[model samples]
Target chain A: MARKRPEPVQIVKQRRDAALNGLVHGVPYVQFLGIEFDRRGDELTAVMPFDEKLIGNPMLPALHGGAIAGFLETTAVIGLAWSNLWEEIESGRFDTDELALGHLPRLPKTIDFSVDYLRSGLPRDSYARARVNRSGRRYASVHVEAWQDQRGKLFAQATGHFLMPASKDD
Target chain B: MNPEKLKMAEQFISAVPHCKTLNMKLTNIGDGTAEMSLPYDLRIVGDPETGVVHGGAVSSLMDTCCGAAAMSHPSSPAGTATIDLRIDYMRAATPGQTIVTRAECYHITRSVAFVRAVAMDDDVDRPVATATGAFTVEGK
Candidate 1:
């Protein structure tokens, strides 16, 4: 079924504030975690500010294992969204908008998410980067890594599959 | 099995701020197995259009239950931390249904504990997700 293609500018904003997480602005869980993003070219990184609320083991002051997984998963979503937008712009389906990343016609759904806790996440600023390995009509795959200050030293890593709801263009 | 073991397990889970924030509660515990639950909350929705809880929330539930199970394991007496966790999603959980997870410490060596878990809503026939992981154990 053919659908209405939104204006180029509207495409970037999608339906919400695209500058932040593509679909995470109104999400209470993501908001509570205080996740932010940086998009440059094909690379997308998710940054999580260190907060007392994120601590899992107060004694060790370690970040909760689940929170780390959440961080990685959320980053992967943003990365996939950004990757799709980049492709759309390249193919002229969507215009290049430096101000905003285009919106996803439909939110991506998680098919599977796995996390490898390499080292204990300490109570400190942590960041994650996700690389989209493949994005097709039916599915997308991403490999994500979270690290403390040093990029080489990772706290955790994850691989996830997202169900990309097919669009009219597909 | 002992009261002291139960207390230890509960205390360890309660100390986690993320667990408190998510409101995951321990429902039951045996020698090397545990059950946990998180009631449906809109705050954790991944797809606002569908109101389905995010897979991350399910992952959190499994990770916590696994940790609790590791704590109760007779071998991991000192305490435990996650080493690795892998979850495969079967489907998105139904909206407004509490997600429950059950985890078991299937095996334990001197330094590590192996765990597996399943998450589901009310339907016992259809599981929402399944997980397997290993945890590091310390000496008491």
Candidate 2:
């Protein structure tokens, strides 16, 4: 008789809630950017509510660019963490609870990021989504799209590159 | 157009509460270029260990310069959102020196504007960081 194949593990479904909590509480800059996580699963979504403190131009009455960048970067990192990439990479040796609670992992530092300004992001109510492009080990890319209140408006888009550490080192 | 730009400048300065806290003031604006200065303040000190401006503050200043450049465009009335900004830090800004940012708009199309800027102390040749950015135009 042929050996029975093991059941496929549902990685994302198992880890979703813990990951979202880590993101909300671990990152200090996330709160500073005033970005709130609304949903997390395969793709993570965040909302950037308008605040005068985050404005770059009071003249334009718009959200500041740095604040937007911070929002996108944070969203990308949280999405990856939620996907259980860190846990999978560190599998078996450590407790899942320890990994989730002890220290939230840092995103591999960004090597480069390119953003295309598509439309004005205004009126304080805006949303963005980040998706990770994973090919193999040691390299990952994140693409983000931000939308203005008018459903049709594509306010901004960004592609960021991060260099992952070697698996054995992790 | 010139008057509108100046009016925008005044409004931009007055609206930013943190800029006021940091003593950042808009000094000049014209011809798709703008200048702003942040006076030395104890609050700006980045590291209690080093007494240099924090990387976060430097990044904010660079972002502001690029955004202001985008806002000064002739067709920009509604405003612009930063799509992306990249900054290369060269050195720590010297203590007790006002950091000045000079930013210029390179091009603008229907949706996006490209900008380049340099932040320096009194000496223009030695810059603290150079930055490039893209901003999206908001609808009027």
Candidate 3:
């Protein structure tokens, strides 16, 4: 009777979830803003629930442009980090935990961000997805699109440039 | 500087929910320029290990300042919405220091107003970030 090995797919999936949870929860600003992430495989969609404190111009009753920008930038950093996670995990260079708490690696640093407001953000749950245009050893660029109701009809879009954290190997 | 416009600017900051959340205060608003401040708060910190204020908080301050500047401009309409904004972060803001932002609406056209802003903490010489933006103007 030999000991059986755990299923590879299930183990990988669990590790992936743990890594992402650590990354998102590590930042205090994300918790303060009440942002959550839905991860399907390697893709991540950021969700910012509506709160009265997010309103900027009460007359228009619109979500604050700064809040929206923060959401986009956060998404970009997470997306870039997630894209790099697999390589570290596959090479067995990164260790993860189910209860990682505050033990996350440093997140990518934002160098610059540009945002275009397409429409007033409605007072509801806002959703955003980030697309990594390029990720190198030292730098990454991500584009983020945010919407309240329909994904096709974006309320805002942003391009963010980030300086990737120095990897353990480097 | 018009006193009426100055009053409007004060009312504007007091009315904003996000401004209240950030504890933002309007210091000056006149001559197409606006100044505002956000007191250091632990909740808005980005990196817990470093205790540094988030870049988002800095940008939010700048955005609101830009809007106030645009509204106070002589050629501005009753309201303005952000069209596009570009922000460059030069360094991390020191913790426990209130960050201040100043914005100037330098140009206005039939449909748009352009603005530039800088955010700094105690170190006025080294800015935390700089921003340039375009805002929509309503009436002709």
Which number leads on lDDT?
Answer: 3
True contacts kept of 2: 0.26
**Please, what are the lDDT tens digits per residue for candidate 2 over residues B3-105?**
7767778677667754554567777777668788877765555333345654445556667777777878777765666777776566777877889898898
Off by over 4 Å in 1: A1-22, A89-104, B1-4
Q: Model 3 segments beyond 4 Å from truth?
A: A1-9, A90-92, A98-101, B1-4
DockQ, prediction 3? 0.85
Candidate 2 — which residues are off by over 4 angstroms?
Answer: A1-15, A56-60, A84-102, A148-152, A165-170, B1-11, B17-60, B69-102, B106-114, B118-130, B134-140
Candidate models: Cα lDDT each? 0.81, 0.66, 0.89
Instruction: Tell me how far the alpha carbon of residue A134 in candidate 3 is from the true structure, in angstroms, after superposition.
Output: 0.7
Candidate 1 on A43-64: residue-level lDDT in tens? Answer: 6678899987678789887998
Q: In candidate 2, which residue pairs get closer than 3 Å at backbone N, Cα or C atoms, i.e. clash?
A: A120-B138
lDDT score at residue A165, model 2, on the 0-100 scale? 43
lDDT accuracy of residue B111 in candidate 3: 89
Positional deviation of residue A63's Cα in model 1 after best superposition, in angstroms:
0.4
Candidate 1, after superposition: displacement of residue A35 in Å? Answer: 0.7
Better of 1 and 2 by DockQ: 1
Candidate that scores best on DockQ: 3
DockQ score of each predicted structure, in the order shown: 0.66, 0.25, 0.85
Give candidate 2's root-mean-square deviation (CA, Å): 6.4
True contacts kept of each: 0.71, 0.26, 0.81
